[model samples]
Target: MRTSSGAGELLVELNRDSGVPLHQQLESGIRTRIRAGLLRAETVMPSTRALAQNLGLSRGVVVEAYQQLVAEGYLVSRAGGKTQVADIAVVEPTIAAPAASGPPRIDFRYSRPDVSEFPRAAWLRSVRRVLNETPYRSLAYIDGRGTIELRTALSDYLNRVRGTAARPENMLICNGFAQGSRLLLQVLAAQGRTRLAVEDPSDNDLRDVAQAAGLEVVGVPMLETGIDVAALEQSGADVVLVTAAHQFPTGAVASAETRAALVAWATARDGLVIEDDYDAEYRYDREPIGAMQGLAPDRVAYAGTASKTLAPGLRLGWLILPSWLVEPMAQAKLMDDRGSPVFDQLAFADFVARGEFDRHLRRMRPRYRILRDTLVDRLAARIPELEPVGVSAGLHVMTWLPPDLGEDALREAALQRGLGVYGLAPYWVAGDGPAGLVFGYGSLRRKEVVEGIDLLADAIATIRG
Candidate 1:
């Protein structure tokens, strides 16, 4: 006899082919699990009727097994007529020794927001209001497309803020950008769309996602103005994913001509465009760029997340879909996780509608700008070899290194000195490209930024020697 589980907690297996009695087998299986600590002390045991129903045995067999276990002190009957594990003296597990570590390293990787800035008060207020006023039925299992309140609020907010003309019915709330992208890409792949084109040096996580969705990810070269439209057209890819508002790594906003051409390309080829408007909220110098989905709503899908604005642990994201893609995306979402937690969706909706979200962004924008400026200035002053690019907006800054300064060696040296620096080599998906480093300043203080740059400069000097 052995004990296992399937979906539920426990499964009891008994060999009827053996001459042993059924009740004895049942008793041995459960006893074996309890003694082995798989079923620990004080754990509630299943009722005899339920156990018998589950194991396809008579109530008498289950009752007999329970009685024997009770007699042996493996289980105890509580006042409420429930059976629970007795106090069995199990051997204590050994604890592992703690490993020593060095000083805390300053991390410059992108998207690490200063969680200290999260508006706990505002969030608590929204959540409290949701818990108090939202109907019990509304709190129950919701549609995969998300609640009407959140979608409506998002529709209004995106249109007013992101230049997107989204409708509530076409939106689906998801567990951040990763799951949203997976749901969309898997649906497209299932529809026989085989190729996904991304910028040559794009966020590699998107590549991993597309591949997992069974789509062939194609890499198109990225130009200063944005994605190379000509190369994208020639790549034989039916779908394209781009950070249109501000391209990652390069921070290149698509030129007006390129944006128009991309829409045309999608329209003419009947291909789809996936606009990753990930961190478009934190523009420092210029006004926020509008999303491409507005130009061709039917031909493009928009994905946005709270990961950048709020904490990533929230795992909150949304997708504004085209009318034609709504059904499939909703079905995908239902099959994926039914829907995201209603509490978050409800709270976020309240956050947006109450204007708390705007206030928080208003407060964070200047702080992030100051950090980005400090990073740029430090890199420019400390090491003239590093040329800061993509400083117009977002939480991070990218700096190009002179060809002679080997990126790999500098990063390794920096890591040795309690510094975390990211290089562009891993971002590139094709032919060799120029060397550069990406510094994420969102989570760092002005002092940390200054210190990190000095350390990077020292690493460069060491590599130069």
Candidate 2:
């Protein structure tokens, strides 16, 4: 059999005194040799037992190292057949990054729901009703598509509030938008579409999710109006993901022309659109922008989450997809995690049916509106040099800084003054963007917003002077 393991010459050079773990060292050696073109495609590798004996190591250690490389696709094993180096063209799957090491010092990061505003009393009332009324058998492994009550409620809610044309049969309830996106990406990848074009200056977590499914993410430029369709046309992406309403961080509403252009492009290319209508409920500027899915229900996959309006802890998100994608996405959901909590889904359905959700949104909208107004006023009063972007809607604003005040220096200075802020640098694929900080006013008290800006002003002035 042809050999790929490079065990003949390289194993002799491994020193027992090396600080690295033996499994890791062995794993690295095999991968390096593959990349060096020393291991030809389909070259057979000895069994771990045989290689261990040849190298004077424990069989289990060699097995562990081989398994690691196999998991990463450096090696491939056919059932009841010899192991071999993976072809250069093979794609490897990746898992999500481990949770961030520790709690951020003071997180002013955007994308967080206002945890302070969760309607606990109403939710408890709804949960109590669901638990008491639900039949005992309803608790068994659910339909995987979601509870019937939720699917019905979601069907109505998306149409009434967000302008989506999806039916109960087309909706799938997952843990949240992250899980929904992952399942969709998995389906897309399974269909042989490897690259997804997503908006740059958007959420990194989405990019992480797509990449975790063994798909390449190409960054598409987003203009003040929306994603640059001209650039998107050039990208040759099979799927285009967009946040049309209230683009995150930069917060540009996709213009009507841009929105129409995207639909036409997708129609021409026979591609699909993933619409993340994130934070569509809290539009202070005008009537909410109707969902893009409404215009082309068969082509657009609409995703909405309660995380922005209610609470992230709820972990409730829904996807309204074209008819073709529904079952595949549902199966992927079952494989990922067997749907979200049934109790929460039932309670949320009750919340929506009772008009309590509308009441909650109505109450929170004005409260957040006041907070946003205060944030803008305070920043103007205290930090005259800083400019706020995308203040018309959503829960947060990006404060652009003058060139003399570098984002990193300003961020460190603010931390010293007991204020938390984030730089926009991490959000971009291309480096050194409009230097700014994202300020979230959702749960922040008026006094806190005022004081935070005061501290930020002092920090900026100190950095500049």
Candidate 3:
């Protein structure tokens, strides 16, 4: 019999002496292969004549086998005289039973915005406008920093909204905040700056980024106001990363006094400040705070991203660097990815220029504010002991748990009741802090937010009892 080993070939052995009919044996073999997932859906089967010739059988036997499998729904006959496996539903193998079951139904993870509210219509219009207006030359490999049009638009926007000292020549568009941070760290390492200081209780992923670049990461203590500028100065690091507007997880705004102290510290030590202006657009109580880069533009490298305002999947972020670091940062970006995609940058520029971006933010801020208020109100009314702190700004609020309860235990209990609550233990890099939970209200609706907090309170009560 003609036999060949290939990805699509099926191996079959038929015995004329056996009591089983040739057609029945072929069908059984094909059925077993399908059930075992060896033959996947839509995989083409060898033609009847070819299979019969290869197996030294009559064409009628092969045809009968094929017709039987077709009737059983394991195979399908397609147009243009082709036979292929049908889209049959197969039972997957259950590897093992889980000890604790699946994840919670309601998630309260931090730093995520309401993606369902993304402005699809406005974005599509902007994309079409950019594609129509863009020159052919702009599509080729050009500036490593980004399209000049996008940089100019960002310059105007940052200056007007955040009070930043931005210039098109000094801005570089990056993949996201993570990539931008990596590029900055690489540039600093090149300059023989080996130490990087970050705010304690900050995002662990950011500290890992610095460590990945072979730089020593030191944690500076966070105060009630913001990062303790006094401790940061003593850290003796050449570069420090700060979230001045709304600190992650804590939602603490850096005070004017603290901002001035940080700027002066950078000036005195000739150190560099990397300002991550993440989520500064979603302030509820008062006017949003301006960027710290306005105070000392030459020393601070201001970074912003569309992850909070739009979506994280876009991977769009920018850095407004000091005049001296422009070439170095751009060079690092060149070696990293040869700059971010140009089309998205152009589309974002069009979106900002047409005022669609600001309009979207205006529409979203009130909804987020109401959600924030609802979360705080529901938690306070349901569980008086679980006090919600940092309620004025950002997408999340930190609540201090009771001194008697452990944060991890409470989180696990909440998860069991289909409620996801995050503990603050992972945020701290050093010494222990009070037990707390972080609730992100951005993705949860008003009713869901209320119900979630009630369930969380019930979980805590059961744990205490």
Best candidate, TM-score: 3
Give the lDDT of residue 245 in candidate 3: 91
Question: Cα deviation of 370 in candidate 1 (Å)?
Answer: 1.0
Residue-by-residue lDDT tens digits, candidate 3, 1-465: 222234335687677789999999999888888788767777778988888878888999989999999998998899988888887723344578886777677888887899999999999998998889899999998687998988999999999999999999999999989999998898888888889988877878878778888899988888888999989878888898899898877878899999998899989999999999989988888887899998999999999999999999999999999998999888888888887898899999999988888999999999999999998888879987777777887899998777788987888888888888898888887648667888987888898898898998888789879
Deviation from native of the Cα of residue 405 in model 2, angstroms: 1.6
Q: Please, what are the lDDT tens digits per residue for candidate 2 over residues 356-416? A: 8899999898988998888889888888767787878899988777778778898789888
Candidate 1 weakest lDDT stretch, 10 residues: 1-10
Off by over 4 Å in 1: 1-104
lDDT by residue (tens digit), candidate 1, 81-190: 77877776232345686657554479998888889999999999999999999998996778889999999999899999999979999898999999999999999999
For model 2, the stretches where C-alpha displacement exceeds 4 angstroms are 1-107
Model 2, 99: alpha-carbon shift in Å?
Answer: 18
lDDT of each: 0.87, 0.83, 0.87
Candidate with better TM-score, 2 vs 3: 3
Model 3 residue pairs with clashes: none
